[model samples]
Target: MGSAALFFFLEPDNALLSDVNGDLVNAFTAVRDHPIAVHNRLKKLPTGSDSYYKTRAVDPDELPPLDAAARFIYLNRFCFNGLYRTNTAGKFNVPYSPSKTGRIPSREKLIEVSQKLQGKRILQADYAKILGSHVRRSDFIYLDPPYAVENRRIFKQYGPHVFGSSDMEELASCLEKIDAKEASFLLSYAYSREALDLFGGWTTHRVYAQRNIAGFVKHRRRACELLVTNIC
Candidate 1:
């Protein structure tokens, strides 16, 4: 959600957006194509724990596309830290946080975002499938894969799949191909010595950042991540 804001701010001429979480695609599409329906439905859902839990139980496929998208937005805007973690059963289990308000995008904002998406292709596919051999030197790819958490205690792992160290190597190999084709690229990941060693030859930097994890400014602390690129 944070990364996707770049497009909103910059208003890119074009983009090919995708994510492994297919529900997000549905929500974005709904907001793009049926803003009024989603907006009206979102207003009717009770902004409470029971509503949150019940909405989570509704299978996305069972609901109307517009409702499914509203469900996704409702859960996301109403969850703790806006986290997208799910249980082993693939059920969204992020408990209701006392901090969050049950807010959904308004119709006008949805219309604006939808308009921006007009010329784009929103997909639910793997990175490699999206970045095929058709890349050209004029292309610039920005990838945000799972962070390279060094220790089990240092970070919270989420999702059905684990992107271990081997996956990092695989990504490096993939980036090598992109670089070979003369396409520029950048990636964000956990800042670690291994990441530096893994991508030594490419330009790299440590970016200091912060996240409001506890719904308070005082709880925000210094954080950093690696910004590695193969762009000249």
Candidate 2:
């Protein structure tokens, strides 16, 4: 559910967007419901190491929905590589990144996003739960689960218990269920042995994407990705 970029691109009249990250989902909801307020709040936040760390230290839960959403967006804009990582205690611990431009989205852009999200169901739930309970015949599902490569330590954006081998097994099971329901689905994941073994039988396509997981432009590299689909 990273960015839900496809959803925004397609702008379907009816769709259900979900993610395991509740804070992200809450931010989306806030943007949808109170774009002007969130935008105003974002305008007041200063962009500097001192202000960034001070805002980061404040618990988002203590703020109202609009303020929390603003803080989330602010942190994303100023944090390292726009990464969302947390410590074992579930506190956001990503260091302030001075290299970032630290520019918030304009009010017009926020309003546009809010308009796109209007009337759509935004949920904070695991993929399995969303697929199990909400999938229907003829529905189109796009799955962009976190990259869980074999024998590699990927950046933990979503926290310690990121996608793992067992989660891949669960994803395979979910694919079967979606097929049985006559729904079309697409999956994007890192091109690796695990991905090939699990999804090679599907209509798989290999693609290369520029990955910035290294958090520096000099270290960015093109990485292979697998696009698996059950569409005819």
lDDT of 2 by residue, 117-164 (tens): 999999988889999999999999999887777665553557777677
**What lDDT score is found at residue 223 in candidate 2?**
74
Which lDDT value does model 1 have at 148? 55
TM-score of every candidate = 0.89, 0.94
- List where candidate 1 sits over 4 angstroms from the true fold: 1-3, 152-157, 213-220
Q: Pick the candidate with the highest TM-score.
A: 2
Estimate the lDDT of model 1: 0.74
Candidate 2: 10-residue stretch with minimal lDDT: 211-220
The alpha-carbon deviation from the true structure for residue 152 of candidate 2, after best TM-score superposition, in angstroms, is 2.9
